[model samples]
Target: MKRNYNKPTQGGDVRPKKALGQHFLTDESIAARIADTLSSYKGLPVMEVGPGMGVLTKYLIASGHDVKVAEIDGESIDYLRYNYPELAGRILDADFLRLDLAAIYPDGQKFCVIGNYPYNISSQIFFHVLDYRDQVVCCSGMLQREVAERFAAAPGTKARGILSVLLQAWYDVEYLFTVDENVFNPPPKVKSGVIRMVRNGVTDLGCDERLFKSVVKTAFGQRRKTIRNSIRGMFPAGVPLPDDPLLSLRPEQLSVAQFIELTNLVGSSR
Candidate 1:
C-alpha cells in the first residue's frame, strides 16, 4: 500500500530550510515504521516534535490517540494547517526546547514523544526528554546515527560519554535501525538512525540527581583525563574526592550506576 504525504499540491512550493536543519523524510515505509514503534504507547496523548508536513501525523491520528505537534518552521506550520484542517487547535507554532513541557498535558497525564529531530539540536531534545521523564513514557525518533549510538552506547566504549550515562540512568535506550541518507528529500551526508527510549523502573537516581548530572558532565567534559583529575574542580575548596574505585577510570569507562556512586562519593567529600 502507498500513501501520499505532504505532496506539494497544485500551486505550492514548500522547500526544506537549511537554517532549520530540515531534511524532510520522504519515505512512506520508514514513516510507518516510526509511527508503529509507538503501538505500546496507545491511549497516551502523543506529542510529535518537528512534524515537518504531516507524514507521520497521519498515522498517529489514525492510531486513535490524541495527537499534537510542535513545529518551529512557519512554512511547515502553514502547510500543515492548510492541508490538515483537523489539527486546527492541535498545532504549536513554537520551539520545542522553549515550551514548558509540564503544561503539554493535563494533570497526571503521561505521554509519548516522537519526531524526526533536527540534526543540530537533537542532543538538546534528549536533555529535555530527560527533564520530563516522569511524564514521558516513551520517546521514538530519528536523528544522526552517531548521536543515536551515543544514546545507547555502553560503558568501556568510546561512544560512552555524558549522554550515555545520563539518559540510561532512567530509560532503557534502544537503537532500533539505521536509515540511509537517500530516503530523505534533501539527503543528509551522514546515515540516520531510529531509536526508542522506554522509561525504566528507576525513578530517582538515589543520589543528588543534579550532582550526578554535574559529575557526569564535568568528567566527560574533559574526556581524556581520569575521573580523579577531571572531577577535582567539582569538589568544594579544600575538600578532596572521596575514595572510590571509579576515580581511576575515565568518564567513558564508568557505568550509569558507577556514575551515581561517584556522585554520591563527591557529595560526601564536602
Candidate 2:
C-alpha cells in the first residue's frame, strides 16, 4: 500500500526560508519513520515543531494521534493550513521557543514532541523540552548529524557536552539513523540524523535540581578546563575543593551520575 501526502497545488510551493532554517523533508518513507519513532508513549497528543509544509505532519495524522503544530514561518503556516485542513484550529502561528508549553496541554496531560527541527534552534528546542520534561513524554526528531550525536553521546566521548549530561540525566537517548541531504528540499550542506528521547523514571535528581543544572552548564561552559577549574566559581570563597579524583577529569569525561555526585559535593561545601 502506498501512503499519499498532500503536495502544493500548482505554483503554490512554499519557498524555503534560509533565515528560518526550513529544510523540509521531501521523502515519504523517512517522514513515516520519523513519526513512528514515538513508540514508547502513545495514546497521547503530539505537538510538532516547525512542520514546514506538513510532510512529517501527514504521517502523524495518519497514525491516529491528535496532532497540533507550532510553526513560526508565515509562508509555511499558510501552506500547512491550506494543505492540511484536518489540523483546523490546531495550527499555531507562534515560535516554539516562546510558547507556554504548560498551557498547550491540560493540567498533567503528557504529550510527545516530533519534528524535522530547524537546525539553528534545535538545541534551544531540546532545552525547552527539558524544561517541560514532566509533560513531554517522548521527543523524537531530525537534526544536524553532529547535533544528534551530541544528544546521544556517551560520557567519555568528545560529543558529550552540556546537552548530553542534562538531557540524558532525565531521558533515554537513542541515535536512530542518519539521513542524506538529498532527501530534503534546499539540501543542507551536511547529513541529518534522527534521535528519540524518552523520559526516564527519575522524578528527581536527588540533589538540588537547580544546582545540578548550574553545575552541568558551568562545567561544560569551558570544556577544555578540568572539572575542578571549570566549576570553582560555583563554590563560595574560602571553601576548600573536595579531594575527589573526578575533579581532575574534563567535563566530557564525567557521566550524568558523576555530575550528580559533583553537584551533591558542591552543595555540601556551600
Cα deviation of 125, candidate 2, in Å: 0.7
Note each model's CA RMSD in angstroms: 4.4, 4.6
Q: What does candidate 1's lDDT look like per residue over 59-102, in tens digits? A: 88887768999998777877787787779899998999998878
Which sections of candidate 1 miss by over 4 Å? 1-12, 236-243
Tell me the spans in candidate 2 whose CA falls farther than 4 Å from its real position.
Answer: 1-12
- Provide the global lDDT of candidate 2 against the true structure: 0.90
Candidate models: Cα lDDT each: 0.88, 0.90
Specify the poorest-scoring 10-residue window by lDDT in model 2: 2-11
Q: Give RMSD (Å) of candidate 2 vs. truth.
A: 4.6
Candidate 1 has a TM-score of 0.92
